[model samples]
Target: MRCARSLVRIQSLRALTAAAGGTVQPAATRKAPHARSLIAHEPCGQALRSLHTACVLLKNRPVATDYQEKSEREGEAAKSLVTYDDLFERAALEAKTKATFNQVLDVFIKRDIRRRGHVEFIYAALRKMPEFGVERDLEVYNKLLDVFPKEIFVPRNYIQRMFNHYPRQQECGVQVLEQMENYGIMPNVQTKVLLVQIFGEKSHPVRKYQRLLYWFPRFKHANPFPVPHQLPQDPVDLARFSLSRIANDLDARVTVYQLPYTDVCETGEEVTQPYVVGIQSPDQRHLLAKHNPSRPVFVEGPFPLWLRKTCVYYYVLRADPLPPEEKVEEPVDPERCFYYPLQLELDLERDLGDDDSFDVDEVDEGPVFAMCMAGRGDQATLAKWISGLQETNPILGRTATVFRLESGVRELQSAAEPEPEARPGEEEEELQSRGVKQ
Candidate 1:
C-alpha cells in the first residue's frame, strides 16, 4: 500500500511540471531562469547593460597622463620644428589686428634669440604690419620702445659698454625716435624723460649735456612744469643755468663777477684787481643802486678782450639770500635780497689751477651757501655744501635750509617743523581710496 502511494505522488509532480510547459530540472539550473525573470521584471537588467557599456567606453578612452605626455612631446617637437620665418609667415597670414600683432611680437620676444636679432625681428614685423592688416598706433611704438632693454650700468662700466656697442647699439634708440616721428606720433614728457635717462646712461658728460640741451626745450614745451607750483621760466635760461651748474660741479673754469667798489675811484686808490665778469639781473641793479649809492655799478665787465668772450659764456646765474641772522638789516625790497647775499664765488679753477688742491683759507674766505632747486641736479652738491658749512660756521649752518624753489613760502615755513602724524583711520581711508587693501 505504501509503494503505490509514493508512485502516485511522483506521477502527480510530473503532471504539474508538464502543466507549467517545462520539464523538471535541477535547482541550480532552474535558479538562472528565475533570476533572469526577476531582473527583467525589476528593471535591473537595463541598469546592468548601461554599466557594461560605460565600462567598455572607459577602458577604450585615453588616459589623462598619456594625453598630457603626448601633448608635451608635440609641443617640444613644434618648438624645435618651427622657424622664426615660419612664425612671421603665419603671423602675416593670420595676425589681422593690433592686438594679434602685439601677441606675435610678444612671442618673438619671449623666444631665446639674440638681442639684436630680436630687435631686427621686431622691425621686420612692424614693416609688415600693414600687410598683416594691423594698424600702427602710438601705443605700438611705445611698446616697441619699452621692449628695448634698459639695463643700467655703473657710470664707468657704462662708458666701456658704450665703446663696445657703439654705432649699432647707439643708433637703435635714435632709430626708434625717428620712426615715431615718421608715424606722426608725438612723444610725451615721460617719453622725453626716458630718452634723457638713456642719453645720460650712454653718453659722456659733454655729449649728455648737448643732448639734454637739444631736447630740453621740447621737454619743457611738453611738460611746462616739471615740479608743481613753480612758474614757467625761460627754457633757454633754465638750460644755461643747468649747464653752468653742471660745469661748476665738474670743477670746470667758470667765470663769476664781483660787484664794483666806488672807494677805488673816489679815494684815488689803485684798482689792483679787475672785476669778475657776470650778467647782473635787473633786480641786482635795483638792489645795488638802492643800498650802496656811492658804489660804482658797472653794467659790463672791465676785462682782457680775449677773456670777455669766454666770460660771457659763464655768468652768475642767480644768488639765493642767506638767512636773516647773516644779514645786518633786511633789504628794502625782499625780492632783491637774493641778489646780494654777502657771499663771493671764488674761481676754484683759477685758485687750484691744474693741481686741484684747495687752500683751507681760500675755501673759508666767506660763508659758502649752496643754492638748490627741487627737481634739479644740484641737490647733492647742496647737501655736501651744507654738511661742510655745519663744521665751518655753526650759526650759518643752523639757518641754512634746502631751497625748494617749487615750494611756496608757507610750505617752506611748515617744512621746518616735524610733519603732523596722521589721524586715526585717516591712513586707512587714504589707502582704501587709492584702491589699496591695507
Candidate 2:
C-alpha cells in the first residue's frame, strides 16, 4: 500500500512536469511503477482499449499532430493550372475530324485569351457555339462543317473533291480548302487532290478512270448511282441523236481525216450528188472570249470564185441544214456527256460581215446551201472526200481559219503600234503658195 501510494504521487509529479514540455526529470526524482498501472491492453477490444491507453498517456500531458501542415502543402500543389491555348491548339489540329476541340475552344474563349488565333473567327466575330456544352457533346459530320469557313476547302485543300461540285461547290468541300488555310491549318495531299477534282478542268474521277477506279477509298462508300431524273430512257434514241448532230458538224466544218461514211446501195443510181459551195457568215460568239473573238466578216465558198469577182455571189449567214443522208457516220453514245460547244467551227471566212437574220430566201432550192456530189460516189474514196469536206464546211471544223498563236501575236503587235500620223496636205499647199519661205 505504501509503494502504490508512492507510485501514484510520483506519476502525478511527472504528468505536471510533462505538461510543461514532455521530457522526464532524473530517476532520482521518480518512484517505482505501481501494480495497478502495470495492466496490459485488452486483446479482444484493442482499438477501444488503445484509446483508453492513449487518454491515460495524455491525461497528465499535452496532445499534438502534423496532419494539418501536410494537407495544406498538398492543396497548394493540387492548384496547378492547364492553359486553354495549349488545349485549343491541340483541339485545332484534331478539331476538323471531330468537333470536340472546337467545343473546348468555345469554352476557353469564355474564360480568357492570350494572343493570336484563327483569323476567320476574328472576321466573323463569333465567340462560340453551344456556349456551355463543350464538356458533354461530340458528333463530327459534313453538315457540322457549317460552323467553319468555305474558303478552307474549295480551292486550297489537297483533298480529292467530287466532279459534281462544279455545279454546287459550296457543299462540295471547296469550303474546307479555304478553311484549312484560313485557320492556319496545313492540309494533306488528299485535301489538295479534292481541290483539283472540283476546280481543275477534268474531274479526279474522270482521270482516275484510267486506273479503273470510280471511287476513292476515302469516299468509295458514297453511293454514286445516277439520281432518278438524270437517267435516260432510251440509249438507242440517244445514239440516233448523235448521228444527226454528227452530220450537221460534217456539213459545217472541214476535216483532214475521212469521217466515217455511211452508204445506202439501194437504187444503185445514187440520188444525192451536187457540187455547190455556200456563202454564209460565221458566228463570232462561238470563239473563246479570251481571244479577239469578234472576227471580221467573211463569206463562205462557192462565193463562186467567178461570182465573187463579178460581185454576183450572195453572202448569207449559215446555210440551211440539209436532209439527213444515209451516208452520214454516227457518233458514239457515251461521248455525249463530255460534249462542249465547237468553238473552232465559227469561220470568219464563211461568216457574213452583216448580220443577215433578216435574209429572205429567194431560191426555191429547198433551203439553199452549197452541196457537192450527193449520189453514186466511189465507196473507197468516200472516207477521204468526207474527211476533206469536214474542215471546209461549217458542219465540222467550220471556221475558215484556225486561230494561230503567231497570227494572234502579229495582230496584237499591229494593234500596239501607233497609226501613221496623217500628212498635213493643206498646210503643205499653203506653204508652197506663200513664197515667203526660202
Question: In TM-score terms, which candidate is top?
Answer: 1
For 167-236, candidate 1 gives per-residue lDDT tens digits of: 4544665666655544435556566455455444444422433454476567555843232323226433
What are the Cα lDDT values of the candidates? Answer: 0.43, 0.34
Q: Model 2: runs farther than 4 Å from truth? A: 1-22, 25-37, 41-89, 93-438
* Span of ten consecutive residues with least summed lDDT in model 1: 296-305
Q: In model 2, what lDDT does residue 194 have?
A: 43
Q: Estimate each model's TM-score.
A: 0.26, 0.17
Q: After superposition, how far is residue 298 of candidate 2 from its true place, in Å?
A: 50
lDDT of 2 by residue, 111-133 (tens): 54431232333222122322322
